[model samples]
Target: MIEILRKRRSVRQFLDKEIEKEKIDILKEAVLRSPSSRGINPWEFIFVTDKELLEKLSKAKKHGSAFLKNAKLGVLVIADTRKSDVCIEDCSIAAITLQYVAESLGLGSCWAQIRLREHNDNISAEEYVRNLFVLPDYYLIECIIGIGYPKNKPQGHDYSTLQFEKIHTNGFKND
Candidate 1:
């Protein structure tokens, strides 16, 4: 599990390949097993394979997410905020867990956050998604996770710069 966590990376470039049903099932199982905040489990998932809708979302959220175009599957993790104060947390945990699970199954995944600012305005991207999918008002689109086989492996990053940062604490070491 720890190895999966460490090996996971955001895969942006995906091959034009469809994911297997069995693998998809495993990914969904991870979501079902995710721990919900306060046991509210205020979350739902929309498995998107519609090419037209995927194209629309890719364009609508083009600013932050252009990688959706190549993804074979997009899982929208929605949260019922009215049901729990930690709905965002619940949804976020589910999203991250899904990413790791997908990677464990040899599938690549990337998380796309739905901007609240866009939703606040009637023209928000969230509004576009809600209208497209006919989602109820009670549900909020937390994120869209793009999944598929990778076209290229993720580039490695050197965390040496972060080693001397003021981020960690050892008995409150002063600068």
Candidate 2:
């Protein structure tokens, strides 16, 4: 699990290959198994492979979403805010779990932020994706994870770069 965590990176370049259903199934299972607050699992995923729609989604954010255009599939993570006040946090945990599962399966993924972003010339990024995907009014857009085989593999993170100074004991210590 630590290896998977160390190896995971924000993959932007992806090969134009279809992701295997078996691998996708694993990611779905991970999401379903994610721990949620008060057992209110607020996440609902939309697995998109449509080319035209992918193009539209590429415009969901003014920036950082262009990579979705090249991804073979994109997972739009939506949270039912009406169900829980902490639905965003719960769904975010599920998203990270899905990314870890993808890494374990040799797939690459990039997270495109949508919650507070806005399209270049259109409405809010969340509204754009919701309208395009026809999501319900109560479903709040969290993020989109663009997934596919990597066109170029990025090197794993070096442990030396970790910020250990951020960690503190029971009593806070400066310096």
The sequence of per-residue lDDT tens digits that candidate 1 reaches over residues 30-96 is 9988999778899999888777777766764646666787788889999877899888889999998
lDDT of 2 by residue, 95-145 (tens): 898888898999999999999898756589998888897888889999999
lDDT: which candidate is best?
Answer: 2
Q: Residue 90 in candidate 1 has what lDDT?
A: 93
Candidate 1 ranges beyond 4 A from true positions: 117-122, 159-167, 170-175
Looking at model 1, report the run of 10 residues with the lowest lDDT sum: 155-164
Q: What's the C-alpha lDDT at position 142 in model 1?
A: 84
Model 2: CA > 4 A from native: none
Query: What is candidate 2's CA lDDT for residue 130?
Result: 80
lDDT of 1: 0.81
Candidate 2: 10-residue stretch with minimal lDDT: 115-124
Q: What TM-score would every model get versus the actual structure?
A: 0.88, 0.95
Clashes of each: 1, 0
TM-score of predicted structure 2:
0.95
